[model samples]
Target: MMTTTSEIDSIKKYKTNELIDLLRKEDLELYTEDLEIIRKQKINGRDFLNKNKEEFRNIGFKLGPALRLKEFAEECKKRKKRFSSYKTKKEVVLTKFGIDNSIKNIPKFVPQTINISDDDDEFQYCIREIKRKMEIIGPARSSNEAVRCLYIETILVSAILIVKRIVREKIFLEPQREIVDEEATG
Candidate 1:
């Protein structure tokens, strides 16, 4: 689901237009800066992939697929699919930028094979692991510009979805429509 009111059944009472309006007003510059910082700090997509492409290959996602990630997220919600993968993707974004998204006890459950300790910040752990793999590259390899562009775009779009959710949750401070209407007439 979009996590906004229009799509999710639980919050169906909320008007979609209102939520979208509030979202449009949020400080998106913070998110944009965070993404830019990630871009500056990281090895570019080509280098990262050249080193650890196998780590991502088994993810089984078809690059350059016609459907958007939001559509895929909606389908997952509809089917009640385990969000382990979604959460993993989110964690990677958070780690890459060292953001602390402290949401816990997410409603859905998925069986995870890896043992994780309560003290471990999974986000930072993932960041370090990927960095290590990149640092250990055997030889420099040629880059495919088209695939790299697609990879970067996909990850950035995914991060945008996560940022949108955060903004929506925090946007409740906005005045209600009735309040706005009253102020306008006054």
Candidate 2:
């Protein structure tokens, strides 16, 4: 069965003794006997998050699933750290303003979509800029100009994806649409 977005979200919010269920959701080839072993172990979310591949293998998971589980654990840990840091920064800002306790209805952070022009000019410009900087710093691994350009473009695109994902996670605050509209009109 295909997992819906809500189902995926619920999966991300894993609870104690739900590691096996998570494995199942990932569509890993797990045996019924493996499920029974995992249930008996009763691993909690925190413990699961802390486990490495070797540790997971020791806990009745096969090598491939163990590796995938370790990756999932790392991703989960990274998300928790990012969220915790965001909360800490928000609290610090609120405390600094002396309105931490007084404010009960703080607005949620919303991500805004930025419209890039439907042309390669901007992307090519970034690639050229990065290539220029790379030349100044040191020679690229490949002496072939085309190869270097391709490498630089790949890095630039990957960086954009990383930033977009971070923003999508609501790690940074943006003005609400209504507030932005009001400011533009006023």
Candidate 3:
């Protein structure tokens, strides 16, 4: 899901037209800066992959076929997906300088291993250990750590959605909907 501030959802649910009007009233520079950060992150991820093509082959062993770093980098560059404001022309324009400087500071890779002593509950123990390690070491490192954090966040968000669905079913309540009355004039 696209990242939106909590206030945006409140505004969307209660006062959508007012939110649009507010958007028009605000200076575009704030939006532009937000877009720039997104752009830099994408570019950084792409560049990291490009710089360590061989290392990514090792990472692919653990991460599997879904994320091939080299290919992802190439795709990012080709799509020019770095800049968030590209889709919305009203946002400010900054000179494209390839990847951001902060990306260069991050390490390309970190070593990790999964230790399984016996076949008894091996799968369950491994999963538990992995989760534990993720919590402990996730924020301490850079580059690969950041990517791992993103994956963890994605999994957590998906799990939350699943739990929300289950709870909604258990409660026997209808899902909330926002109704817009286009015909109503004040």
> lDDT of each model, Cα atoms only?
0.38, 0.64, 0.42
**Candidate 1: lDDT over CA atoms?**
0.38
Q: Per-residue lDDT of 79-133 in model 2, one digit per residue for the tens?
A: 6555545556667888887768556756666976666544545556666767776
- TM-score of structure candidate 2: 0.37
Tens-digit lDDT track of model 1 for 1-186: 233323333322334343333223432222433333324544232232122223323333232221222243245354433432355677776666666565553435685454334454443444454455446632124284434443444445444444455456533223233423443531
Q: Which model is ahead, 1 or 3, in terms of lDDT? A: 3
- Return the clash pairs for model 2, or none: none
Model number with the top lDDT: 2
Say which candidate scores most in TM-score: 2
- TM-score (all chains, Cα) for each model: 0.16, 0.37, 0.17
Q: What are the candidates' C-alpha RMSDs?
A: 28.4, 17.6, 27.4
The TM-score between candidate 1 and the true structure equals: 0.16
User: Could you give candidate 3's per-residue lDDT for residues 1-186 as a string of tens digits?
Assistant: 122334333433433334334333443232443333334443332234353445544433223321343454354344443443354322222213333344564456775453434453434444565577668676535675445655555455444544455457543324335434685432
Separate clash counts for every candidate:
0, 0, 1
Q: What residue pairs are clashing in model 3?
A: 39-82
Ranking by lDDT: 2, 3, 1
Regarding lDDT, does 2 or 3 come out ahead? Answer: 2
